[model samples]
Target chain A: MDPLFEKGMTELNRPPTDRPFQAFEIVFWHVLDEMFEERLLPGDVLYETALSQELGLSRTPVREALSRLVAEGLLENPAGTRGYRVPDLSADDLQQVFQAREILESSAAALAAEHARKGDIGELEEIHRREILFSSQENRREYCRANVEFHFAVMRIGGNRYLERAFRPVFWRSQLYVNYLAEFHPLNGEELTAESGHNSPAEHAALIRAIARRAPKAAAKAAAEHLRSTTAYRILLDTERARHIFGGSSR
Target chain B: MDPLFEKGMTELNRPPTDRPFQAFEIVFWHVLDEMFEERLLPGDVLYETALSQELGLSRTPVREALSRLVAEGLLENPAGTRGYRVPDLSADDLQQVFQAREILESSAAALAAEHARKGDIGELEEIHRREILFSSQENRREYCRANVEFHFAVMRIGGNRYLERAFRPVFWRSQLYVNYLAEFHPLNGEELTAESGHNSPAEHAALIRAIARRAPKAAAKAAAEHLRSTTAYRILLDTERARHIFGGSSR
Candidate 1:
């Protein structure tokens, strides 16, 4: 059994106040965690039987989870193949992903500005604080998680369940791009300054301030600018580097 | 077997160049068609065993189709219940749906303005022509179908697969709102005039012209204005009427 799978299973087995987690959901989050943590790199193929055996479960739940991930655009089942692989997104795919993030997240941020309660602002500030802490400590993994949480917190504060739901899969796909960026361009502790242009904490703080001030247009602009800066097209323009980061060749 | 399911099965059995439709997919579309046609009203509960028996298939595919619809927000599985019910959307849900539609469809229209080829415009004009023909003939069903095709065509021309895919389920949920509007407020031939404010044809034409002129912002504004006119909050504000249309009571 894979050590990660065992660790996930132990976590899943812990009792919760709500209903128990389903088998496939456990598998789904486990796989997603692996991808985010870079244990499962782009282009790595996952066989249903191998995963089922590794997790000491039947193939049905594993297959279900794999199909769900594929449906969410996190994984792709190549034509005429049974195995699901982490998608090697092309430059165009990254462009579309970022464009979508800008549209959806900006709208959410604007709505959050309108609807955000004091508690909501507080929650956002807490996440932003963690983001800064993680960045200062150069804890890339935790910083990435906190960054993703900050965006989702904005979406939730928007008070539109439909928009929030639509944002989920797109956000996950963008995380793949984030992971690649972090891998190719590791940020040193000193490079976390706003002048470095990779300073997510400063950008996030601006978004938080806009929402807290109830400035819808400013909030929307800040969100869009943040995404545009983070997903700098110049990085994606290097076909060779993108190919290397996306695993030697585009699928 | 139900005649609708039989008709859908016949269509599924037809020869195609690419591939045969799966059983679950056939069920999915069949159910969606029934909903659009108002043959299956909101608040109706669908039982897997009953649907399988009606379609003369096993429970597996029916279950899969129902679950897919639930995940798509077209149907909801009530807590502690085995059946899936067509959602009886609240006024708030309608508001959120329209807001999302504005955000997504306007983005799509803007992108279409930038990316549309001559052939793409021609295709949209063709669909618009059908819409006008149907509206003039008072063929509400066909007009509705053509209307949906027009929006989807705009999305396709946007050249963003991610946006297009994300638009699907939200688009479907919004269709429920469209159906209810059509049911409650039948349009007379005279009412189809632009002065009557039920003039979808005119609004659609304005959107087409904007896209044809390659004016991205104009295209976006036209699309947003069209949705705003069609989903007038005055209509949704009548909670009692909305409840009656969604089926006697709110879910």
Candidate 2:
């Protein structure tokens, strides 16, 4: 294979232009969405040759998109080689990712809940309502988007840029689990009543209440508990599924 | 002038190879350290031409190191940029860095107080002793290093890999504060009459006792209070110093 094909991260040195940046960001965002959607996995290579041809752009823009994707933790270029590939999902990684997410994002949610914007709680309430509706209807795509929106909104309101920056990679890394969440619609608490049952509606409702009440401790606890019950464990269950869907990762 | 000097992130294609990766990493680590030392600053462009000449290698490894540095949050190659440069750090950036450190590392210190390793506590005791000696004699650099070691050891014993990683960059980004702590080092209990006094040796001793006694709450309080005092006026000092050291950023 070509050296660039072998190493995924090194390509970031290429000079970029403004016109290419718009296309690059647009493509990368789309690719990242696909990465989380489970359409892209760890080992499968993103072929610049094919993408440039398909996207009707030069390899420059496509490669630019690839670099940003790599930076975002959606892809990796292993030490010895180049060209980007999906980072393989692993059980340990899943746990670490969630553990970090639990520590950081939970605090973010708590802070957001406490220091939330005037209408933020109302907006989150709407998100919760929409997520539950989408999940009930088994609309995986919409649910995933809403799930991301809800959490991201909370992080923004968390009022701590460092926490947000530090936790970002882990959040992106957990997209594999998000893909799994989409498929199984895991334990949308409307039905069975087990500890693992993640009732999206109820969780969202509680989250809004916690935030509305200006409750950091409650918001933090609720966020951690919600993640612990729903997203965290669900990632564990989907370990093999990730390998099956995205192949294996070298890292 | 070059495209790599632009305002956002974009991917670049890299042809790579299977190499030891050690040389670049060693260099990269030093490069990052120098960045923290303020040897590198925002808008100071990376010269691929010059670095390759000095390293006596092709652009491959040099560019690769630069790419990873960008990923490490020390450098930025904005969209349409052909070069990498250290990111500008504002007071808000510095404050965010410290605030999250206050939350996360304090929690880690508290947690470490619960299940601290025997060797860890012993080592911490020695660290405090050194700080006492250093403060007595005023050994600035050694005291600063000891300060980092003490905090990092506490975080390590916390046994939370996730938290450890999250805490690292924050600590690193605040090295300037560590250096400045030398000037702020309070003499003793008498000097620490106010909240913002450094008396770090005493604080560290208290922290050790808390951890030794497995008092999580006390350990956290000690740790948080120590940093709160040590860095309390750092923001104001930095703002005042900004014009001289960072006139371009003195907005």
Candidate 3:
């Protein structure tokens, strides 16, 4: 077993006091987090029996959740096979995912600017503050979670449930990219932390300000720019890594 | 026993020389069409065994397809039960669905404007011309199908597979609204036909022109306006129906 999987298992073992999600949902998201963090790499076999036993869950819900992931195209459903494998994320797939964010998140921000109440705006500010604090502490996971929370808050502020639902799978898959950076990139953990520490907070603050001012076009532009910045950073890192490997020009 | 279900059955019964979709996929989309057309309204039970028997398919594939739809939130899985139910589309649900269209389709149009090839432009023109011809013939179904095809063609032209995938379920659900107008609205078929004949072709022509000119902003704006126009028409019909029901001044 990979050490990353062991760390995930340890985290899963620590019971949450609140426990809002169902058993199946808990395992479902845990496995997804593993995949996002690159703890579960492409072609990593997910054994149903081991996962169920380890999570203290029954086999049925575990199978059900895996089936859902398989349908979402994140995991491959090998015919007549008992286990699932993580599907490889190609460059084209990553590009399309971010392109979708440019469209969906920009629209979401514009709607948020138009429709967000004072309370909604306050919630975004609160999340931004939490993100800032987390960045200072170098708590990557909590910072990432706070970022997701801020985006979802904006999704609700948009006042469109269908937009929320339609954009959701795309958003979760995009989160994988952030986790990919935090875990798999050639940069050390400290460098990764320092990179997000320097970049994410300012972008988030600008996003909140745009929403607060009710500037729909500005909000939309801010949201798209924020996503593009992350993509740009990741691509730059990938290019650097490639240059290091192949002895070629950075471009 | 419903007439709409019978029509869906006939369509599904026809043997195909070039069957591109799997049996499960065929059944999944067929059921969606039935739901959108109101052949399977709220509270209608979807029995896997009966569906399998009627469609000349096995239980396993039908079950798998229903599971997929259930995940998509079109079907409510009854606890401790074998079948599914169609959920009612609330007014809020309808509003959100169209709002999603405004975001997604606009983004798709912008991308299409940026990336569309000459062949893509020609294909869109071909669809537009066909739509014009269909409007003159007052063939509602063909016209609606062609409009869907045109939009999907633009999605393909956008060159973002994830965007295409994200837009798909929403697009399918949006088609439900068009079919809802045909089936359940107060207007007769002739009136609906007349309405689309007057409105849709002009909007579609404008959209084609924007894309052909490679004007991303114009294309996005046009696509969003076209969707809002449809929503406006539907809301007008709904208001009229409400007035007829409650004996009050139309709000």
Candidate 4:
């Protein structure tokens, strides 16, 4: 049985958005949103027929959406099956992802510092402002969206198109996994609750200031630290989850 | 007409390898080998029927091989055509590729330093020795094959599957372009002819020593320097090529 359409999940039945997107685009974002919200956990099958019927659309769009998601690495087709499911990555896999991100994003930030024009800096500032704005809202999804935009703005400002393109899929897939983790196990729950929207903006401000000063090394360090801190929180969350599962004897 | 099959290329008509392999594998490697040797330059067309007929095989295997190459970013289907062509990337695009490679490969070397066992170091040494041996040989293709093996051994020793997977396509595509460039313009013609394979092995040895000592920072630094030096040579070659093309007025 599909976990998404399983019993007691009545809230997800809302009609697909009537926005001016093509049907495939609509379905793609809907599935992605569900994955972000952890409504679709690892092993939750995305059956095209079920999704199309639930969303009041034909199967073609849903199928195309699944294919795109699979290509994006957010979902995978199980062996001998047509349906897609959230990919299951091991701890080593997750660590490699973070390690790669640290290398790429830090370089990107440094390059951004070296190359960012006034317009680029201004754009990043605007994105950070929106990120801060969304963080205070009750909608976590909106905050996530703004966060993605902010980081991508930095990547674009870095002025390395190949780096940006290569980084995009990894960043998105990592976020999908990280967001799913954060759903139940808040990484640093107390700090998250206490700071709410404050710390991220402050961090972004520091990064922006470094870039504004054209201090390449400092900007790279700042970006790397930002990502490292996030990963640190994730590690803490993983530890906490394991402790719970093992009756506090693990670790 | 397929550039590979056109005029004066009688050497390619030799029977596909006698080694026990399927048809598709032979076609794939043949195309890849041609790309590595710069026999298929940028803008060279790869007509499926032509390649299939020339190789004395059906089009299905050739088509699959082309698709894989396209996925690997070696070939692209030109607009309004069924044939593929070597992609034409700008100077900026090539620079970005090298930048991304520097980030990924350097970090990979660092990780390998941290995690490489004695056995891993031994394997790398063996691969490096093979590279040295091939360097003395007149066959540039054999030297390249050994070079690829040596680098991939380091990636494997790094013990990061995600990084290795992400690095593979980028590395291959960059090699394709670099090899093409080197055909007409040796990156460092004088030094290359003077030292031949001697200098590269020494560089590899230094990297191996760092990893053997478990000096992650030193290993990463060495790896990055190696790539940076290679890129420096490439820049020189590009400048020389430009000077010739523009009657020495472009600079």
DockQ of each: 0.53, 0.35, 0.48, 0.27
* Best of the two (3, 4) by TM-score: 3
Query: Model 4 over residues A35-113: C-alpha lDDT tens digits?
Result: 6555677666778889999988998677666765665567887445677767764555566777777777888899999
Q: Per-residue CA lDDT of candidate 1, range B3-46, in tens?
A: 55443212322224355556776688788877766777767888
For model 3, residues B1-251, the per-residue Cα lDDT tens digits are 22432443224323343545567766776787667566776557889999999888997668768888877767877555667876555555666777787778888899899998899999998988888887778776667667777778888888887777777767766665555544555564545532343487799889889999999999999998887677334654476563332221121
Considering every candidate listed, which one attains the maximal DockQ? Answer: 1
**lDDT (0-100) at residue A215 of candidate 4?**
93
TM-scores of chain B, in order: 0.83, 0.75, 0.81, 0.79
For each prediction in turn, the share of the native Cα contacts (below 8 Å between chains A and B) that it retains comes to 0.47, 0.45, 0.72, 0.42
Number of clashing residue pairs in every model?
A: 0, 30, 0, 0
> Alpha-carbon error at B234 in model 1, in Å?
5.3
Q: In model 4, how well does chain A match by TM-score?
A: 0.77
Best candidate, lDDT: 1
After best superposition, candidate 2 residue B106: deviation in angstroms?
1.6
**Candidate 1, residues A36-92: lDDT per residue as tens digits?**
666777778899999998878898778677777776778888555678988875678
For A1-251, candidate 3 gives per-residue lDDT tens digits of 22332343223323344544556666777787677556776657898899999888898678767877876666776664668877655555667888887788888899999998999988998988988898788776677667777777787798877777767777767666555544455664545542353587799789889989999999999988887778334654476463332221122
Native-referenced TM-scores of chain A, all candidate models: 0.83, 0.76, 0.78, 0.77
lDDT of 3: 0.70
Looking at candidate 4, what is the lDDT of residue A116?
96
Of 1 and 4, the candidate ranking higher by lDDT? 1
Per-residue CA lDDT of candidate 2, range A1-251, in tens? 12321222122223344453366655665566555545665567777788778767787667766765665566777765666777655566667667678888778877797678888877887888888887777765566567767777788788887787777667666656555444443343444222233375687678778888888888888888777766546646666653443335422
